[model samples]
Target chain A: MNPFPASDYIVAAFFLFCIATTVGGAFVAILTARVIRSVCGLMICCVGLAGLYFFLNSPFLALMEILIYIGAVCVTIVFAVMLAEPDEPPSGQNHGPGVLWGVVALVVSAAICWGLSQLSLRGPWVAPAARVNDGSIKAIGVSLLTTYSMAFELISLVLLVAIVGALVIARTGRTKP
Target chain B: MSLPEPFRLLSFLVGVMAFVGFNAAYLVWVERKSAARFQRRPGPTEVGYAGLLQPIADGIKLLSKQLIVPPGADRILFMVAPLMVMIPAMISLVVLPFGGSLMARDINVGLLMMFAFGSINVMSIMLSGWSSRNKYAIISAARIVSQDVAYEIPMLLVVITLLMITGTMNLNEIVQQQEGWFWHWNLFRLNVNPLMPLTFLIFFTCMLAEINRAPFDMAEAESELVAGAFTEYAGMGFGVFFVAEYANIVVGCSFATVLFLGGWQSPFGLWSGVWWFLLKMYALVFTVIWVRWTFPRTQFYNLLNLSWQLLIPASLFTLILVAAMMKFL
Candidate 1:
């Protein structure tokens, strides 16, 4: 039998699952003193976000999320870990300042999360009248050439600059070593 | 569009679980075989003849292995990291269109949704590295973020070009527009010109960088990073990250197929769309593996320079040419 009827529930469950994973991971990432645990938490969060992408209807993004984030980003971070000493030195007497900083971070993050959720859930959204194009790959191609040509060109330029800038920055640090 | 709630929920649950399991197992097998051929060694040949049963054996071995948590490591966070890595990889599959009609949901803001979800991945890695209390893991995390910042912009620019051309963010519609034969595919020139082909090449190259295959895989260079962010992981924790990586490969291949290779559309009129789509995707995946083994890794700075100097400039030039062609010629 078709399980379509339960789709809403499934969606809700997955959504909650992703949120829990992300938030929980973030909590662990930030709260735990051990740097490795934080990295693990970050990975968990990304995985959840990937799930959210799937729900959002962009499998490509989901793949990119995992590949770029987990495969590339996480691995790169691990490399940095190996290169530098990043572990938090055990604190002996600075309890007050640490607690204050923790409180400040918690309050700020909570406020932002609450505000965004309220805006998203309560804000009025208008539906588009009639879909202009099917939004297919072909349609995207046509539009790139015809409508958004300037922006497309600009992105290419931006990429060029980023590549050059990254090279320059990374290169500058090398001569000293 | 309304339907009963229970069945839909059941189907979704089943679908997610099944796809996750399949993607995890199959991708491992694919990666092993791919790596084996690239290295000129027989990979997993003893297990089920050419390693067909290798994944099964691996699963059993990993499950049996003792999951050793380092004494200094944060217990909960360490346990959670691999799940963090894997969940995103599994979740991202929903939006991918295996066939035109086969998708989880066709959201209006699909593109933005993807980027937003994607940004969180770096945070997880940073956290894992910091939490591990291991020096190597911390360095790997920092490198991961830097590399992401370096490559993400170019990759995004490439996506924007595609979005501009199609005028819509929906993946299905994009594929539909390219229906017909191979020429109709966006990767090739429709009118026999050099610009479109060049665009396709640039996009393909960017895709490789985005996927972090060799030449771009500086983050995990075994000789340098010593297993990078995953140096501390073992058993299922490691397994989760491994599965996520393979899933990403599948995702990347699928995107290439859809964007350039006419996703699910028949190359010739005789066959159906799904078969052609799979062929194209597999071909791209194979190419990824081939390149990984064939080329030596690039220096990090050189890698960054390639994107900025070569890919960015070339893409920009092509953009101008495409605009000019569209306008007059």
Candidate 2:
């Protein structure tokens, strides 16, 4: 008799579901000819990823994944779609070159995925010897004020620059209008 | 009396599924009520006991609505986008600790994994915009990319600060460290230093931006963009996005609780920590909603500038001050 219960099967099944969702969504996002369809596929992929994050033990990240990506990012993109013309212009059939490009993109992405998967699956992972500290919010705070303070400071700077840059770029385009 | 491992895993999965479904429902009600209060309107009062049945009603309505696809749109992608937005929202709940023992797994690299999965949101949005074959969707998608890139940096920095202090990424462990009264909470009193308040404030601000709540909801500015990237979505497709958005709010509130409010730690030391944690999280969520309803939507350029100019610099300054304090004090 197997020591593991049937619940483990359930867990495994859920895991499989998440993986399938992610991979399938990604496939649809990239392979589908319709750009809008591709966007939907991407949303599916994100939802699957959020599931994976939940599995991975970071509920916070999972929520962030959904909130930031689905709530804000996806909605924004939808608005842009309504504003900008995204449909490909119709042209006479040119399957030969299109097929060639499609094949090229597929091969490149496949090779990358395969290589990364193999490296991760086969790579030697070092298990930490007796975790020194529980990475609690307190510890995170302590370190933020001490060790990684510089990085924290720099990130803010980058945000500042990005904000300014976005304003300038968007504004410059509008003056001529 | 030993439970088999498989049974335990099965129970966990069931529990998670229940949590996701229930939370999704609860959040919709919460958002409506919250939005209503903010707008000085009585929201969803007709359904079961002060609109408690509103979510069920909404769910039924959505379920019955025709799932329509626009002509000339990619039928397959149109069908799938909502699922893309939703599944991730559901999946990301695994690592959240409802209490000390309530967690799916205690992964060592929990922090990194969360970020890796989180980045996929951008790609998904971009795809939705592209597939929609609409000009507005394309612009919204471009804006999302720019906005995400801009805000993510400060958010990461804030997270990095937490990681550094904690010396580990396990969410449970992080909460465990903040035992005892409110002072023990990371936000209130950090080693008797006043500067800690600044850190907390910076973290919270960055979080608001990260979640894209106002004054940062430029992406879906209804007045300007007409529902933004989701303009093409209808019926259940729209429904999924709706649920996902509220789910994201829960996630952000939960993170604030975990990072600063002392996850599961009771503020008064009298009640169980879980209650306090929940209260803090909900309170934060309320604040997000409150801000959303209160502020006029920011211009897209101003939104970007807020991140790049204001938040980024302030965060950087706080980081340096913290480092200096650590070194000298």
Q: Identify the leading candidate in terms of TM-score.
A: 2
**Candidate 1 structure quality by residue, lDDT tens digits, B84-187:** 66655555555666776666756654554454445445555555655576777766666666666666666666666666566666677778878887788877
- Report, for all candidates in order, the number of backbone clashes: 84, 72
lDDT score, residue A130, model 2?
43
Question: Tens-digit lDDT track for model 2 on B250-319?
Answer: 7767877887788887876666556777788888888887777787777888878877997778667666
lDDT of 1 by residue, A1-177 (tens): 345756678779989999899889788788876665566678778878877776666544565676577656665666566566645666776788889998999899999999999998998966433455654556656788889999999999998998899899999879964
| lDDT by residue (tens digit), candidate 2, A87-162 | 6655566788889998999899899999999998999976533433554556556777899999989998998998
Candidate 2 C-alpha error for residue B71, in Å: 1.5
Model 1 vs. true fold: TM: 0.70
CAPRI rating of model 2: incorrect
